[model samples]
Target: QSEIPMQKPFQQVKELVMEYPVSENEPTEENSYLSYNLVVGDSLDVEKCTAFEVLDYVLLSEPGAPLKQALLDAGLGKDILGSYEDGIYQPFFSIVAKNARPEDKDRFVDLIKETLEKIVKEGIDQKAVAAGINYMEFRFREADFSSFPKGLMYGIDVFDSWLYDEGRPFDHLKKLGIFDKLKKEAKTGYFENLIEEYFLNNTHGSVVVVNPKRGLAAQREKELEEKLAAYKASLSPKEQEKLVKDTVHLKEYQDSPESQEALNTIPLLKREDISRKAGRLYNTEKHCQDTLILHHDLDTNGIGYLELLFDTKQVPERLVPYMGILKSVLGYVDTENFTYGELSNEINSRSGGIYFGVQVFGNAWDNKKTVHMLGIKAKALYQDIPFVFRMIKEILGTSRLGDEKRLYEIIARMKSRQQMSMASAGHSTAVMRALSYFSETACFQEKVAGIDFYRLLDDLEKNFQERKEGLIAALKELIHYIFRPENLMVSYTSDEAGYHGLEGEIRELKAGLCTEEIQGEPAVSVFEVKNEGFQTSGQVQYVAAAGNFAEAGYHYTGALRILKVMLSYEYLWMNIRVKGGAYGCMSSFRRNGDSFLVSYRDPNLRKTLEVFQKTGDFIRSFQADEREMTKYIIGTISELDTPLTPSAKGSMSLNAWFSQVKEEDLQQEREQILDAGPQDIRNLAELVDAVMKQNRFCVIGSEEKLQQEKELFQEMKYLL
Candidate 1:
């Protein structure tokens, strides 16, 4: 009796537009980072200009918005595309107004800034925010991790899939996704915060204004071309050959005294520290004071570690990333410095030639010796202070997508080798573990690991031809990926002279007592700060904040936290991880006395500027939004409730029973999550923003990128 009707094939994409006027600033460094444009003119025909709002940010219009054509007739530019680079992810804007007077620059920036402020002040439409939140929730709830690989691979191929400059595959993928029922049974309440996190912290975003600096632009382009050339040469021989044939005007480097000098400085690991607890190894050390504290975790019949870190005062900042790369590279390539093929050889030799492997940050790095490799883990060791800086640089410097070529090559070899070895009954986990551990130790996090220095030399040799374009393209993505504004570390610190620069910058607290009818009844008060500086400073670049209050008794003989939710994260990683020798480190923080300090994991006592700088930067930069909160909350909650495997649960329960982490602590941790609100987050954001402006960052990588990018390092305040 019922007829099923087909639904329409298309749904309307809704967009909201907000427009405002802004005054142009003098292009100071402080505001340079904010995308703004400079326009030159003798006078303003304010009536014939226009502006636009793209994504969530403001933009001036050389080209007005499609629907805002009417507004452009009143005085705005007609093009918004000038400020944005095609194919990049960041939100951007442009400004071009005709007949604007030379004196109008300041007025323009001011007008635009004011308009932006008004937009922010007027706030996001609650209804819109809610609908977006709900839609995201629905999408995530319905997402199937199973389809991720196919979807992601298809998306990646989009960059190369164009035929005759026309993109047909994009539509095909979308249609197939729906028609083939890959997107069916969609749920609407999963983790919507992933999208939120992407929007707020992606590196693709930038603010661009037209500047009359041809020299600067040219210099940037030249440098970029060189960098690009260097990167392309690092791929495999097949890829490299392809790049050469496909690209043009590529430059290559030659063996030069400058590079030689830089290469000579990287040092070898010279020490180790070991301790025992409860009949198991508890601590391990390497490369100066870098330390790792091990806990015999029953979960994997292995260990978990906590790293205690220090600043980079003991090491060079330039060397930090270089060393990391070297650690990874040296672990693999048979080294001239050591006989027996470095650690892999050593393990196979020790185990009568079995298999070996190394793992970095949970990913397989040296899978070649999988047969003889048993197990290995390696991560950088640094202090909490500049940990953020280290993370930023490390993520930026390393290849994204885990260098899929390397992955495939290593995997294929391992698979084939494993098959042959299995036939001989020679494949043993012990042998493999030994090899992996050895590589993990010798080559772990070396500066040269991910770099194609040899390729750069090859590119340099080619004299800017045969593979320049691909190299340049790769370099652009790598540089932009690493240097995206989202990676900048921000933090707060009082002046060494003892000035609380942030004290009055934020709104004062509005704490008041609430009492019952009884005159002596105890009461509670609500305290909150207004814009003494929340969103203004821009230091707390990643997170948002806000606050609110409810009635409670103040004199009820109960102590309350003035700064209830002071937040901190695992700052730096120490040598808690070692190949075949140590495990990963875990840090714990418990609220203590007046000022607080928590557990840290790191070995080196190297407390340098890089360490402190990065730590503060990370603290200042990280933003806690709904998505972050959801992921963290969900992941943690899931972990907490996860049943210990049959073997581990009993021990975990026994330990919890013995330690103070029984039901109460667990309940408290959960309650902390429940008690959090949006305003409290906003308040914390402001505090972080205020502190980050004056902080310094330290680096501690190797000789290569650092030496080559010294000028880059010079851009920041460096100590030693």
Candidate 2:
């Protein structure tokens, strides 16, 4: 342990392990959780640090990595997540066991240590290390920062060393040479040594177990009420009087408008300064034999982005849940040519990755129609395009999908994730639920991803044995029905050279494509449940109220964008966030007339809805000076002009086509947004009143809170 060289001496490793036990209100859908983080030393130098980066992908982050497989095999949790966080001075390795039991916390730690010990003794797999090094280098070299600015990412990386060390602000960015050196050193057992130094022998680590407790949020609320009541009881009469005055004064201050002089001092981009036209993404539809190709020829730095869209109308509504399970099954399932592990490793070593999902897009021209497309999205460097196509062919054509044991694992993991998403961001769930009463697009969304999807996962997991055969048959039936070339449409984004080469790849891929006829009649979706309460163990609530203004005899206009800004920032902000003490609130009016108001992390359920109910009054009395109005217009335009990557632009163009949105429509909307006035806002009062008057709403939050206001809901039940 003392043989390693260092610039400075450090504390000796402790003999005992440190364990931190934490308790929190977990979603009723999941159990306890544990995060086993081992202190894996610091970013003192580049070579060792970059090696750790590569080790992360090899160990757990990459799909079907050995560590993830080990944990899954041990039956510790449904989904195990592992990551290497180097944003701080001292980087640590984290292994999270989701949907874990409290009693299994020690087992998680022990299993992690055992896994690393075994790796150290038997040596890290050379294949994994090679794949890991290649992947890390590819990501850094590509330098695609998602949607964030490149300089911003670089600045954040600079902090990795600037804050801890006095010198070398850009130390972390010098990874190319270190990565190359580490790849060569891998054959010398450099990574195995790291495993020994950091994990097997390192005692400066902690096992954090977060135990879930039912009714914790309700208990805490009662304690807070008691504490506040006692504090007020102890206040003197004069103090209480002053308290009332102070609170009134605060509200008055909040209600007051900003001074014109102060507002004028802020910089402005006048209406004439910005463009009135919208930038349309490149879309030139071309036809190859028996398939539609949506070619978005853009400069993607020699990387090709491909999308294979197959219409899902042929898939009966009952099989929608199985579609989600199928997304997880493909690539992970054993193919005719390759085992699951080999397939996953080959993917990581060669190209970016392949993903499959069923998407629902609302028609821009008609709200009743939906573009139900099952898409195969993938990316690869120009040179690796052939490999990507070959893999896709094998997965769609030759993959076996009826494995009972494997399907059970996939379904269990999805059920855990469904519960987490509803707990963390229930606002989306609530809004979808509210809109599902009328909008077919929203209805389809609810079936695939909303609470209904969660129920499907729950049912399958609960009775896997009895339903295994049917589930397997459904998977097979869907695969044959979905992968047919009859309805296949392709979207490709690449440079001119790559674009030309795509036809050949598609021609080869076409041979493997399914072209079977349907054996049975497809059934339509049937489900309607609105004005419902979704109960969760979360302390706060996500309250949503939505209605279709179109159905209410109201037409959509561009002026509504400015009105949205006012309601979201001025009215809803003050009432729901500042005064009501909720974390956030939003008001949105879409062109298709689907308007919704949603609250995030809100404490009071009824008060928030009451605020939504008064939204029409706020719009009717809307008032603002010209200068203040310009700010709202500028904010809306800023959102419209957010930066996009080439691939994103390509995907957006395809989406717009599917949704039936025209460039002229976008331009008109921008012009109206720029020219909107106080009258425009007042004119929207009718639309707001129409949408809010119906009172179709859904809430997901504390069980106790939902029970207190149970009359607001037609049905109340647990989310899972």
Candidate 3:
């Protein structure tokens, strides 16, 4: 069956390598995407499937994708992409040459084939393969999908076993087991053979060419109908009858509902098992070498988690943009001790990972104040703390900031990624833009990681040659200013054994850091919002309106979280998505009194804003039955109890301390969420109304849509 999978289709095809070109893209899409995909193997073969995943990481990921690099050198496309996809009944492999022309179709196919053949003849990089294995192994141990519900993510991982092979629901639950065997097989010829057997020799595949288009979906649908009709006509009468029956059964299954008895089989958390009090972090603050240190003694399986947060107050306003740029390039450029790739490999081999980012810790009780800092987070085995600290010192304190070419490459990549993510994350971008009008906390966020940062990246990418020397100079000076002993604060999470060696390492880390003291007050970056609209090439608009309730004399409450659930799942869902034809909408009320009501992929901009404006009315008149209230309280609790890694816990504690979110506040909020009533939500309606009345808004949509609502915005321009 496997040998002849594509034989029937092959009979009607004009070529073994088929090309089905479609002259269209998503509605109003500004750019075209090119993809090359083929069915390789399935999840049923665990060893081979896992090997393909590792191979994809080595050959297709950033920091280097050698095969994709070859394609880029050939000028076939602007970006090269390839990957192995599993966790399904029939998994496939895909290689895309972004921005490549239709004529380069054959060139892409040929290049992929030749590359595989060359690698098969020669050998793959053992070190890279090991790094790939280590990478996934560490992630498996971490078991942290901080962005999503842990149980839901686990279900996603386990579905392959339960859905595909119900005989063993927990078949794929053991990920590390697969990795252990894979590590041994990788050092042999198993991966190469797997590649040849699935990718090189597999013929059950098709080529798809997608051309850019706007407002041509109807034409594409009609073409699909004609082709489908022709294909159906080729079938025998009995075969066609079976196809019709099968389709009817499929639809019936999709519409089917489980019986109440079957539903009762699912487990529920009893009230007795639930914790009444909130979880408290293990934070023991002290001082060492004139640096503030917060230690979290937690079980980490011999792993040490350390966070270095240096206050950004000393950074001059002029250096803000450069400091943001430094976050993207540090730990990713050539250091005096190691090249970026080598350093990455070494880090993976010995430790979990070393990373950098900018953080804004706004006091939950006071929006008027914030703790802005540059953060470096590292995790490694207790045995390897010395190596991790050395690596951190090298990258954060002495990275080669003068390499213009490498810096340009990093910024360009950053620009590409930011642009790609902007399409789906426009709602978030809009919120940041809207809140920057008044909220200093949002101002700092937007400067480092939001629209302001994107603008900086855009300007730099377009004119890097002219901006190179000065930008590098500013980054160098800012890095020095940031890594000083005075600004550095540390947080470490580990067993006592991990801390046993941390004191000496902390001293060494501090000694290597800059000791300069500024003579005067530290400068701050000030930002002003334009109340602008960003015109994009999207079919729908991301409409957002935000304001801080603190200005309205309102404070944060646990009831706000319950209201969040109701609005997100009920009010906004019904008004914006179900009735208004938008994809989704949500509202957020943070402890700092910042709030935003936003719609995702909304069609009518004016209508969405009107819906947002009426949200307070919804909450004021809101009523929930006992069952519904219980469900919402449970939902809020679910969010509050997200599974956090040890490292993540340490980071959270550090941020909480800086933000003034104390243990009593957390426990009080938990109790409030648990015992919340309809009145609790209703009482906040006045605050919501006052916040919405501020009328600070931002919209990111197609140029046509933005033009239609042009009166709403003070100014509008192209987002990218």
Candidate 4:
């Protein structure tokens, strides 16, 4: 054997850099909006710039800051105000303003440039920096680590640090010191120096503008098809045969069963690692006057999470469209004693966030009963509890909805956001629309966020000048029904001391709201939802099929959940993603016994649907041995043990209490999950077969694909 010459790490890195030369500007006219990105040459090393990044976020776009206000005034309010992307070789700053009116693009760019020059000359306000530091500190301490495995988070940190040649990965102690140092530096004008040196002085930069042109998506699809056809024609018959063989071999390997001895070698948490005891439930309910209070005491490190749920039973159905917009517009507009800017700054300084939204949950005792709530959710420091309560009162009691110019601006901005969401999250949109046909909760959700909601927003945006009076009246009516004391349910999560300290203040706040009883039975209206496929100009496809098993008097078992995991990870992944080239595919089982199969960023709608239909057969034929069952059981239990933030824990407890999901029920579910065998998976295939027989589905995809499979859908609609 001959020894090969080895290259040093630096040489290897240099060679790699030379292989992929950075492009100054990649031109594109494919987008439906005018998108701009201004990139700077200088690198902001991650280890050093983390604090400055946080500080800069506050000054440039912190809700009601001057820069953001300037953009809003310029009709660029929907733009992504300020965001930075760090790179290893050369980091760059980005100021993106997308979906801008063609006529306003020039002015928008000029405004952004002017704002940057002013910041460079005058420096940021010290008060803003201080508040930003406080907010950032709170966020760092309350970081949510429940979505993924803790070990995965740690691994990612380590890998990034190693790749960037930065310092060691951060831990709780290390982060505290880092935040303290950053705050001290921010107060000393360190961010101003960064602005002048890295941004103002750096001449090496590029301005990329993506302008929209009609039929762009269609043209691109045609070009792609032609290119693929040419490539296939160029390939030799032997090469094509080999490619097919390779694909089949790969699928075989993915579906192969592992032996018990082989599985034992892989690293995993054993059964002993799981705690047999159920999660701690910490909610205590009390009544103050007519208002209901759900409180939880947890170690929150001197932070408080307060959420208010106002019953929306008395809200008239006519005002539903206006109620949909209330959450976005409420805290963002002027109040009686404060301008919108002042209110934004006040809330940012005292709390993590103060947001309002609509929430719906099924009643525990009667699944047919739907609880529609308008929720005001907020989080604050223990000392700022009084201010949080006061602000909530002001927002509910004194918010002015009559500012015509401001209201129009808010609606326009909301329309822009919804359009963007429709493009990127079409899969979720399709699933919501499909599920809406079968379940009450799903129907309400669709009315609020689905295609119907998008249509309502579009009409308001296009005909605002004509519909102004009706819109304002509807908003005012919504406020009247949703802000009464009789409809209030308050829930708070904090340390024991924080809860006791704020109890009196909360009671006083509740007493000030209207005491008139909301006299009505909950609104119940049956809707005849059309089974439809929606068309969009998106490049990819999203397909969803959902069925309501509960309504059919069938309930989900632990075996069905296990079958879902197997189908999603093994069968669907292999067929829809690996072979068919979708980005992702999943089968989800909801607590309400509703199941949905969704394909994300898929290329083929008809093929993906075929794959979904085959799931029942796949599950029926699955022959997992003892080791495979153990592996899946362990994986499921690991998810159950995932840690949640104190605030999240409190919310989960409250939801469980309200839903009457007792500890025994959860324990039994866990047992069923662990005790599930291969036979159970085969039995659950019957449920999958039954669900597929309904022949109900909704797809959001390219118009070309929708037209090709028009007969598969009962009705077809265009999203944009």
> Highest TM-score, which number?
2
What lDDT tens digits, residue by residue, belong to model 3 across residues 581-634? 899898999887889999999987999889889988988997865555676888
lDDT, model 2, position 291: 85
**Candidate 4 collision pairs:** none
Q: How many clashes show up in model 1?
A: 167
Candidate order by TM-score, highest to lowest?
2, 4, 3, 1
Clashing pairs in 3: none
Candidate 1: TM-score?
0.20
Which tens-of-lDDT digit does each residue in 555-654 have in candidate 1? 1000112122223222322211221111222221112111111112211212222332233344445455453444334433333444333123333432
Models 1 onward score TM values of 0.20, 0.93, 0.85, 0.88
lDDT of 4 at 269: 59
Give the per-residue lDDT of model 2 (tens digit) for 326-430: 877888888998877677778767887788887888887566778788888888898898888889998998887876777887888888888778877889989
Off by over 4 Å in 2: 1-30, 43-50, 520-523, 527-529
After superposition, the stretches of candidate 3 with alpha carbons farther than 4 Å from their true spots are 1-32, 74-78, 99-115, 147-151, 175-177, 206-209, 213-275, 516-529, 624-628
- Model 2, TM vs. native: 0.93
lDDT of each: 0.26, 0.80, 0.77, 0.71
Error of 2 at 21 (Å): 14
Which parts of model 1 have CA positions greater than 4 angstroms off?
Answer: 1-326, 333-669, 682-686, 692-720
List runs of model 4 lying over 4 Å from the truth.
Answer: 1-48, 76-80, 87-89, 102-106, 120-123, 149-151, 154-161, 166-193, 236-264, 267-275, 364-367, 515-522
Please rank every candidate by lDDT, starting with the best.
2, 3, 4, 1
After best superposition, candidate 2 residue 656: deviation in angstroms? 0.9
